[model samples]
Target chain A: MQKVMMGNHALSWGAKLSRAEVIAAYPITPQTEVVELLSNMCADGSLKAEFIKVESEHSAMAASMGAAAAGARTFTATSSQGLALMHEVLHWATGARLPIVMGNINRAMAPPWTIWTEQTDSIAQRDTGWIQIYTSSIQEIMDSVIQAYKVAEQVYLPVMVVLDSFVLSHTNENCDIPDQDKVDAYLPRFENAYRLNTDKPAAFGGLTGPDWYYELRYKIEKDTERSLDLFEETGKEFGEMFGREYGLVETYKLDDADTVLVASASIASTARPAIDQLREEGHKVGLVRIRVFRPFPSELLRKLLAGRKKVLVIDRNISFGMSGAFYAETKAALYNEKKAPPMWGYIAGLGGRDVPLNVIRDMIEQTIAEEHPEGDIVWIGVKR
Target chain B: MLEIRFHGRGGQGTVVASKVLAFAVAREGRFVQTFPEYGVERRGAPVVAFTRIDDQKIYIRSKIYEPDHLLVLDPTLIGAIDVTEGLKPGGWIIINSDKPAKDFPQFAGFKVATVDATSIAVKHRLGSAAAPIVNSAIMGAFAKITGFVGIEAVREAVHELSPVKKDENVEAAQEAYDTAEVPKEQS
Candidate 1:
């Protein structure tokens, strides 16, 4: 059925549809509504799941890890500071090979104190071995949650479904909620032979010397890489069942374009119209929206961006002294390619500052007017 | 796509009003998106919300600027803030006021309409008389003035979304729809 719901409620509905066996989450702005709805569903008996109330975000991940370690489909959500609190356990969940699906609202990290959207929080965890999938709309957020569990369980690696804070999290839109029976057919029950069982006495995550630790780390990396294909296969199968099919990267008007815009999360959604306007004005502009950030989709990006006149990357999060994270990643992905385009990095819309269509148009125009990038990072709409 | 910007105080159901309207529009098989100003909301503070209705899925995530119409839940917000800052000329400006549309001379070029939503909300016992919830009545007035959505859809949306006083809210919308004051010249 089609329902108008906030992205947070969509996450809750996704978790309920996936039949998450255990939900452990701490309340934070934007992310609080996700857990609130899930708790309500649990209380109303609509979804039968063990809702674990944790005192902190750290405990939330720890409990989720514990639940997943016991062979249960565990889900948890947090944003910004809350997500920062789970950094240590985030690594442990991956190292333990637990397929815990977490919904992390991409709120900007605070010292100045903000609860608004930014991609830096989630991008900081890029090395944590968790598969990151950034979503742009409420519908994708809901669909990705179920797909996250499917891909995570197949590869035995945790998946972090990241979305913009207020842009997608608080915004309400009409989304088609997949039927429960259809979802059941798409994603079966979670079963793991390595689950902690009393009958089969085994010690887990005790300690490993370099002799075994190196191989263990290698195995994690190998499986993390394998998730790319699993995610694609699962998405294709899901599309066969449900109407919406997702991909690692979604391209808009890129078939015969000279300039391409690279963006993730809600920024990518906003870029579509900017691209359309630019196209109407006779500018050969297009968009390459990076949906799956982890496993990077480097090959797909390299193929799409090669031979283009220029590629402008708009990042909502800054990587401090460097450029935008996506900018750096895209550049690195295309470094060896002979036909690689001259890439320009732009940082815009941090801390909930709006990235209107005009700002996006400005980025494209600046990139088009310049012969080469003047600086490592071009800050858009920032006061000098 | 038809874009609407809603103006109201924080204590009022400004955001919910946008969502309820979006819900109603979506129920009619059109695509809709609604969201509030991304800020720390406090009661009585000026708040703004936006809703976009389109025949196809909306891809623009930015807040609405140059809205096709405006929904002002609080009449006091007119001069306090530029309620019509980016409103398109000739677009409908639906306001919740006891006075007629002609009372607001500043909105000469636009199609103006008014409904005493506060009185209607209070009469229906939707909220306390001091701070009655006027969103439902304003939505009804919106339905009546613009005909963007049907009155039945508004009632159904209010019935589905209102946590308490569901019937009262539905009745408030019906009464406002019945008595909404749209200038015949503009209509």
Candidate 2:
């Protein structure tokens, strides 16, 4: 049935539909509603799950890891500071091969203190061995949570379904909530062969010497790589059941375009109209929205952007001294290609500043007008 | 696409008003998006919310700059802020005021509609007499003035969304729909 709900509620509904066995979460702004609804569902007997109320985000992840270790489908959610606090356990969840699905609202990290939308928080965890999937809309948020669990359980690695804070979390949009029976058919119960069983008497997360530690790390890397294909297959199967199908990278009007704008999360959603406007004005512009950030989708990006006339990357998260994280990753992805286009990196909409269609248009127009990018990092709408 | 900007203070259900309207729009099988512009989020602080209704999916995730219409829940916000800052010239401005629509000469260029949402809300006991909740009443006036959403849809949305005073809120909306002073052409 179609319902108008905030993105946070969509996450709650996704967790409920997945029939998560355990929910461990700490409430934070934007993300508070996610846990609030889940708690209500748990209390009202709608979703029969053990809702664990933890002290902090760290404890939330720890409890989630414990539940997943015990062979339960565990779910948790946090934003900015909350996610940052879970950094240590985030690595542990992956290292232990627990398929815990977490919803991370991408809020900007605070020293100046903000609760608004930004990608830096999730981007900082790129090396945590968690599969990161950035979602743009409420429907994607709902669908990706279920898909994340399937892909995570298949590969035995945790998945972080990330979305921008207020842009997607607080916004109410129309979404077709998949029927419970249909969802059950699409994603069967998660059974972990490696789960901790008292009768089995197995040692878990025990200290490993130098001889086995390196191989353990390598196995995780290989499995993380293997999840790319697993994600694709699962997404296709999900599409067959549900109407909307998702991919690692979604392209808009790129078949015959000279200039393409690359972005992730809500920024990508905002760029579609700019691409359409530019196309109408006779500018051969298009958009490539990077849905999956962890597995990187490097091969797909390299293939799509190899021979373009110009490529402009808009990143909402900057890497301090270097460039935008996506900019660096995309450039690295295409470095060896002989026919790679002249790419430009732009940092915009950081700290939740609005990146409207006009700002996106300006970035594209600037990239198109210049022969080559004057600087490594082009900051848009920043006051000097 | 039709865009609407809602103006009200915090604790006045400004954001919920936008969501309720969007819910009504969505019930009619159209696409809709509604979200508030977040600040420090204190009670009585000026709150701004937006709703976009379109035939197709809305991909723009930015704040609405040039809204096609305005919904002003607090009439006192008229002088404090430009309630019609980015409103379209001929678009409707639905205000929750006891006075007639013509009383607001400042909005002469645009179509004006007024409903005593506070009185209606108080009469229905939706909230206290000092600070009555006026969102549903204003939404009723909006449905009456613009015909963007049907009164039935509004009633259904209010019935589903209102937490405590479900029947009272629905009655408030119906009363406002009956007595809202809209332009003759629009009426």
Can you list each candidate's DockQ?
Answer: 0.89, 0.93
The list of candidate 2 runs beyond 4 A from truth reads A28-31, B185-187
Model 2: number of backbone collisions? 0
Q: Is model 2 an incorrect, acceptable, medium or high docking prediction? A: high
**What value does the lDDT take at residue B167 in candidate 1?**
94
Which prediction has the highest DockQ against the true structure? 2
Instruction: Give the residue spans of candidate 1 off by over 4 A.
Output: A28-30
Q: Clash totals for all models, in order?
A: 0, 0
Model 1 residue A173 CA deviation in Å:
0.7
lDDT of 1 at A7: 91
Worst 10 residues of 2 chain A by lDDT: A25-34
